[model samples]
Target: MAKIAYILLCHKDPDAIISQAEQLTAAGDCMAIHFDARANAPDYVRIRSALKDNPNVTFAAKRIKCGWGEWSLVQATLNALQAAVAAFPRATHFYMLSGDCMAIKTAEYTHRFLDENDKDFIECHDFFESNWIKTGMKEDRLIYRHYFNERTQARRFYTSYELQKRFGLTRDIPEDLQVMIGSQWWCLRRRTIEMILDLLRQRRDVIQFFSTTWIPDETFFQTLVRHLIPKTEIENRTPTFLMFSDYGMPVTFYNDHYDMLLGQDYLFARKISPSAHDLKERLGVLYASEGVDFPISGEGRSLHAFLTGRGRVGRRFTQRFWEAGNTLGPERELFLIVCKKWHVAKRLVDQIALETDIPCVEYLFNEQETPLPDLGGIETTLTKRSRHRRSVVRMLFEYFGKDRLVLCLDPANLDVIEDFCGDTAKTRVLEIECEYSDDYLIGHARRVGLAGENSPSETVARLLPPIRNDLAHESELIRGAGIDGYQRIREAADRAENEAAITEFLGVDADKAQAVMRLDYLFSD
Candidate 1:
């Protein structure tokens, strides 16, 4: 029999933790609860009472207050693991999980998978810059250098500076090491856990140093594992499915987000929620009554249960029209236009030009100076002016027929883009429906091979030769319309030279030199 433990640090959402516990127990797994010391003891007692029926569950003796970047979280985890190991001595492996996390696979499957790997599945996400450390402020207390004693500080500074300056820590580190952020959950073999505890015991100074600083949960595991075992012994991926979104925490995990989960190349659909209830019902009905093998519609996709009966007309139309039309195909070169208030759009456009090789344009309508209207019926002068400006901008895009393939990132302005181009063939127009934080957007772009090194202007200029050739017959007409074609040619050459210089400075080869040379050839003509 395989034994697994869940160390839950319940702060605000005890119910959520309890829900996960119920699921884990149902899968015939043991769980251990570790309520934070900062939590109300009375509430903790009540929570403990609620789980009294479960013999596997037990409250930990030691409790710690966890804060961001602080050692409290690590201490709590270490304490929990110690208690769990003592309680479940015969257990083969120990798994760590968070309260907010939902399991996408059964405990049996996870246990078997871990046993097969014979390795510790702890993610070591490497980050080059330590700028995130500076942001560790709480209640006006600066915690960036929190746990550093004089000797440790000297060692850390020497190591960090050497890594950053001489070795170029950011660039030299492997992608896995550079982005060593684990899922805050891991499964470790009994031997590995023992080794970690033994290391902690021997290196009291290092452990004590970590205790005063940020949660260092990720770093501690990563650094220790690297030291103890050969790099081959570590499994970089985890079995759990983590669903993330550009906006807030993912409310539901779906088929679309499954690929993001690092490991488990072969994953069955599991952990169905209320969001999937409607899809489940439809699948259940199809499987039970119709005796269908796949239970999927003609298009190899099944209808989701959560969306059932919510938008009947819309759903019917989606099933009949949109579903088939929206099938994913081979990747294509895409230009994303995120529409917003005119100023915001302009700023984002500048950033897009600077950061991405893909050409992205921004269209903003509202002026920043304008005051927003109150919820009450009273209309402010600034609000009226802003509304007027938006109307004018909307009219301009409509008249120019530039609405296709343009998305409005602002929720308030999305209707405009949708109203204009929603029914159009998706081949020419695509809408990014999800809200994305800047970090998430950047990360997503990087993951999808969209975050290229070149700026939009540079990429556009490189591709301009083909575009110019296509319009060669109309060049005279274009020139007659007061466009300085010669000036553009000269500018492209100058830009190419400047880019080559910049690449040399950055200690990198110019991969786009041929593309740049093509522009030079166009200019020479």
Candidate 2:
């Protein structure tokens, strides 16, 4: 007799929501879906039309404009809870879900498990005691009042925060409530849900205080369920298996996650991409079937790591790559091959790869097609930030070991070249200026929608000298272009000795390669 009402909060993908809603109510359970007020009118209309005939399915009356990291999220959840209560009067428990979540377990299994447990399944962690917030802004979340949405309006959020700090302005939590944080997804006893709703009505002060705080949806019910329910009667965990990236965005599932998603222990897997039709269809069958539950793999390292990153060293590499700010560089010498033409640079890279045992990376800056024709990716390379450009360079140097890589630079990322080349300590700038920087500038202008801004000669005459001055100090200044430029770089790479080095050079061995690279970055500014 464990009647569950699943509250689904959705903004987009009506078809997926409809699919989930049908399966949910088909299992004899009820559902309340709250579509975001900001979502397309057509989408909302379509959802309502599809589910209108189902007696067990209902939509929340109030749809709030649910901005990310805003209090509106909690309000939407409350509205859905109210709708669920009214629509399913005999509900024994409430389960919070997102629109994109797919059930991995059969609906019958969920009902049976809930009946056996007979307790509120929710995560309620005291922030001070446990480190729950991965982004590391936990204390500030409750202690300060956030006027702007952190995710959407980062600059304004930080500005408001700084202003508050400057003026010594602060917000206080009520002494009666214990500040807690946890996942928003949960399954609560009907009594617990009713009590929380009643408390919101009676305690205007608490609601008012939480209204302006950042991401109150995470803490609002999380804190309350702990305050209301007895310790032993509640289970501090959620049934949904949700995962997020280092950037705090939810990890999306696709058609390829077929086996892992089906074999997972959780009742549901979250943030499924709209393109995941194959997996969704399979899960639909699983949801309706009376099949055996996947055995719980004993608690250990999880496959969640593979979901966000590539392989074994994924977490360590990501952490190292991003955290490296002042300490970003190769530990030894680096050979930097610079060119204005994409064809010349890519040609030299390929040639170098064949000639040497060392790692040769083409287009150190990512473009649509590094060695071939990818016009769109090439255009994106033109707008890429200097920091991102340099960060990847640092990542490669770190990954391959210093003096172990030869990176090719194209005018596609001209800013990174100018900035990086100025450092003659670790990097040796090898370039043959065949087309006087002006030729590259004019060609790039038309592609980037800047040709109309200035005539070719005027743009070059106004820019060439100063650009030359900036690069003159860094570049080796060889007077060659095209085929000659490619030939010159190849000859440089083929050499075994250098005037700057006392020892002979070898392609793979850094100890010997240092002779040809000559410059060391250890003391470089």
Candidate 3:
């Protein structure tokens, strides 16, 4: 029996939580739930009643009044972890989950996989440089003082932005520890969970710092684990399946997403809407397809080895994308799009190129000064560098002419992207809907700039504006033309093109189109 304790941080839908708990509960595995104190008292009672028969089930004695993007969220998780450890002392592995999350893999298979590989599955990356913050508020989260309101249940955030404007107070970042952030969900070993708790106790300053951080839940555990654990013991991968839309909200899975859900070889999938009754039924049917004891034995280990080996091979195959080779392009009047999710954007660009017979090249922004790929046809420029703003802007100035088109996939890059394409009337923009697949993990796109020899020193020197504060430089080009005006121009351009080409190739309507304009705070330096 594989001793696993699943900690569920539940807020609403007692029925759903109970249902999921029942499905996950087995002879060897136990469950510990920490319901938000703000939740209905009756619902909490009902959930407790529902789990009355389950001997292995436990609930946190001290419930936390959890709030989104607040310190309380982290506290709730920590409470659940403590409860789970106390309840299931014999457990080897601990999984942090939410009430909405459903187990995609059967208990037997999940146990087998984790037992075979003793590695910890936790995603950790340098916070400030990560794609996690679509807004340039990475500094705001790190330096600001954020408080959770009890009466209003609101998150009161005091950032350097507002302070600078009103009182001229400069930002104060924690100098002792570096903040690391990733997906809130993670699976870890028993020792790790205990070590985390111990570290939290010792590191009072870290705790105090994070208490005021925007989304401490995502950063707290990740930072501790990264700071304490060896690289070999940690795997930069979360086991849960979470689908997020382009807007960065948890995508509610419908019947159409059933196939994608089934395809994932994951232990769980999160934020499944309670309203998706049909979807829930389908998921139940799919999960039951394989019996609990669908004998894997040595097959599971072999499969794991095969997958890991294949991944290594794939990395080596794509090494050309990372290597510093030769400069390829200075394409004539080209269309450039800057995106974080390269693979997702690649498919759309390829389709557009195929349909229009126009030469398009994806200059992958990275930290390394890799020689650009051969830009004869549709080419991909990949590098491992972090500061791609300077390189990307330089590429636009050098390679693309005035009669070019540049569409930035991520609005975060628009600060620099708009600097080039804003006033250029000769440039045209085409709006496209690119559905990012969760399977394709962000590659070098999430590159963290370390103080190393591989730094883009020359590029930075030439660009003048530092990557960190580039968003601060107000773009008069964008301001004067107006966001609405730019949208009108893009819409007109899209309408003039073949309707089929616009719709089929770009995945957007030409008639009622809009430029992918982000909110003001997203670009605030």
Candidate 4:
């Protein structure tokens, strides 16, 4: 069998690590585990107990601190890699993983994927050029002088730079050549691992430079690899299917979205959790052949059972919205209902409204006061708690019935609404999926309506043509009206603010008006 070594940097959550190790071992791969020296004794004991029975597992001797932009993790990873290479001299590849990471494919499938790709499996995390330059600490004289001023320090930064400087030529990194910050969890061929080790030894100063810098573990390896082999290697956009969080917590896969991944050509997925159980459950059924049954132990047990239909209660809540009359009308108006803490949701709604013409309404589901806007058509305050529920229900009913589209702008609210409404679709209700943020939810809602798709690019493209046309038309109308038309339209827009008049002037019904208003609101501010 082709030998593969699994290296993991574990702190707590031994069960998760062991569970993942089981998956790796079942794939005919050997496992080498490293516990952060800082981990508590109990945590270390728990880890040992979990892996004691696994014959393929070996623990590392040294421990290191794992910090952001710190070289400790990279140092630990390098240590583990060296040990793995030394012990398993003939191993085909070294697979690095985190304690919280889960394998989406079985070992058989994973190995086959590596074989087929004939490439290292690393996610390419690139920032925009503007954002990239912003991260540089060269302006910090202390760091720059310590690392870049001296020949030894500069040489240590990267041999190429040192050579170029020696030749009296300035180094200009290409714009398209993005800074490669590879995923901490990646798979590398044996030769690649050896080459990296050789490079480290030859350029010890550069390694030291990284050691003193606030660089992340994944970035260290990625930057080194990119600096050494810029042309030969390629990052795998779809290497593995997994979800992982830095904080050791149960992985939650909200909804049945995992089914969406089956169609994609990814080798693995990580960070799967109970929160994501709905999607995992469906995926488990559809792709049972893909080792989806890999036993989920530890804190993930509840989530795993939930996905497998063995949990007491589902993670999602069903919500119901009762409409009073035709609030939306014949044309549908896209409405986003934001119900979050005031400070967070207010800015998000304002930005969305200012940017798009989509109509949005703000609500504080739990607050006693109904939201009232002052001047900009944006809600300014949450008042009147006594009528909160009644007002919210009334507003939702009116918005839906009037043909106004409504999207709940908060995930927690979505959970509540889902629970309250059950699976019934009363007036075209849509749930927005977000990663625990209201901003992401609102962004998704707008993207869905404007783009007819979820991607950022698609949404921008869809909105551009109409926006350009509107601008041109408005410009001509304003010029013709000689400022009077502009003032009249602005006054009309302000008066027609509430759902009815706005729709009438726009030659549309309440729903269409609401949608237009929402689009306007999103773009206006």
In model 4, the Cα lDDT at residue 106 comes to: 50
lDDT of 3 by residue, 279-302 (tens): 776665444345643221112222
Candidate 3, poorest ten consecutive residues by summed lDDT? 437-446
Give lDDT tens digits, candidate 2, residues 1-525.
Answer: 788899999998888888889987888888999999999999999999999999999989889999878889999999999999988999998999988888888878888888889788888999678888766577777778888987888899999988888897887898788877889889999999999999888999888888888889888898898888898988888888777766778888888665555545578888777888888888888877896555543111133442233222212223225333533444445555666555665554555566565677766455544432223332245344233555455555566665556767653334444445443325444553334446665454444333332233333354345445544433432322211212233324323333222121222454544433343321121
| lDDT values, one for every candidate | 0.45, 0.68, 0.58, 0.50
Question: Which pairs of residues clash in candidate 2, taking residues 3 or more apart in a chain or in different chains?
Answer: 368-377
Pick by TM-score: which candidate is best? Answer: 2
TM-score of 4: 0.46
Ranking by TM-score: 2, 3, 4, 1
Order by lDDT, highest first: 2, 3, 4, 1
TM-score of 3: 0.56
TM-score of each: 0.44, 0.59, 0.56, 0.46
Tens-place lDDT digits, model 4, residues 1-525 = 446787888787666665667666765678788888878878788878887887778777677766544567788888888778776666887887766454554555656667766666665555332233233453231132223323334565565444545775443333323445545667777888899999878777666556654455645666556655544465644355543332433345445434333323454456555355455445443322454433221222222332244222335332224322312333444433332223344544454355445445554444424443332322233333222433443455454444432333443343334322322223322211112233443343343332222223433344355434433443333234322101112312442543453343234466555554453433222
Candidate 1 structure quality by residue, lDDT tens digits, 91-159: 677777665455534455555666677777776544333332233232112123344323335587445
